[model samples]
Target: MNNQTITNTHRDTSLGYKLGVFGVVITLLWIGVFKFTPTEAAAIEPLVVNHPLIGWVYNFISVQMVSNIIGLTEIIIAIGLIVGFFNSKVGYVSGILALLTFITTLSFLATTPNTWKMVDGVLTTNFFLLKDIVFISISLLVIEHNKKYI
Candidate 1:
């Protein structure tokens, strides 16, 4: 490719990457804030309660508190991701955290009861959890991009 073409391609890729990162950051921040609400807390109860690693949290704390804690963690991760835009080391760590977040979310597909069902001879699962696959991919890309600077 000519110099101009290569430069254009690089610019386009960078824009796409920025958009993906922005989407993830927005999603995490919005969901994290929503977790503080009673409705969101209740909605997530089933998933949290069923989680093997985090289910025990409910034993010592109220449902709202548990949700609050998760929400706070998500907010922190989102902030870290934003900062990662300027700091590669922070970005690498934040990307890893974001990756783990989605992996754990995807695990809910298996851990949560009634998450999967057979519909009209087709196997269907919680479509919401499926979105995490894209998030995971983005997180990986973020990690890869930042790794060059670390």
Candidate 2:
């Protein structure tokens, strides 16, 4: 409405954008590092076991192996995203990874909703998977905002 109000709004949105990128960097890097560990690999076993899209990875490679690859990729992507903060090209690539990661995780809701369990008819999995939606939204925003640079 007013110039001052518009300026404040713009500033707030900019801060939110920066924070979102930082959050994604921290979260993905932390989780990505752990993905290589036995604990993290075991933790995702059930989710992977029931997954329809990528579950077959276990059939070709051991779960641990698959987890290792995923972890390494995440680390690389995290690095790229950090670079993206300064370099739009790298950021674009990391943005693609973020989009794919969240989309895949969200797909889990449909492929293996049973893993999340249902109580009173509502799937508990929705709660767990819903977080991906937020992450995806952040990724989408990052992508949209970066389109000008790309």
Candidate 3:
């Protein structure tokens, strides 16, 4: 191959590796957050202000069980992505989940009362949603480029 072709190939490979690493890191970080952190403080109580839509859902349903189930599912998906198992399915599912979560967060922000009155407003401090968006984008890119690795 020509030098230009070689450089392009190398760049593409590097991007894939970087995206894969990002996916794994993000997966682990969320797993840690959900598994180790106090669910009440981190999710239930704070979500009232930070993610009121989710909070309302929590109030309307079995918050603890549903949250735990979701957390477990995330951990499983993350493991699959990190270990390179069924990556296409995982990538697509993860992307969908991330998108849904982001949309729900937006809905939560819109529905919450006096959302902007608090310094720790849901929209302002919702890095989880933003990070998920990044993760979803990188994951989709990695899957597109490294379908064989999956």
Once fitted onto the true fold, the runs of candidate 1 whose alpha carbons sit more than 4 angstroms away are 1-13
lDDT of 2 by residue, 1-150 (tens): 356654553455477788888888888889889998999899777777778878988988988998888788778877877786666667777888888988887787777645567689975655766777888988888777656565
Please give the RMSD to the true structure for each candidate, in Å.
Answer: 4.8, 5.8, 6.7
lDDT score at residue 109, model 3, on the 0-100 scale: 45
Q: What is the alpha-carbon lDDT of model 2 when measured against the actual structure?
A: 0.77
lDDT of 2 at 135: 89
TM-score of 2: 0.82
lDDT of each: 0.89, 0.77, 0.51
**Which residue window of length 10 is worst by lDDT in model 1?**
1-10
Q: Which has the greatest TM-score?
A: 1
- In terms of lDDT, the best-performing candidate is 1
Which residue pairs in model 1 clash with each other? none
**Per-model TM values vs. the true structure:** 0.89, 0.82, 0.52
TM-score of 3: 0.52
lDDT of 3: 0.51
- Judge candidate 1 against the unseen true structure and give its global Cα lDDT, from 0 to 1: 0.89
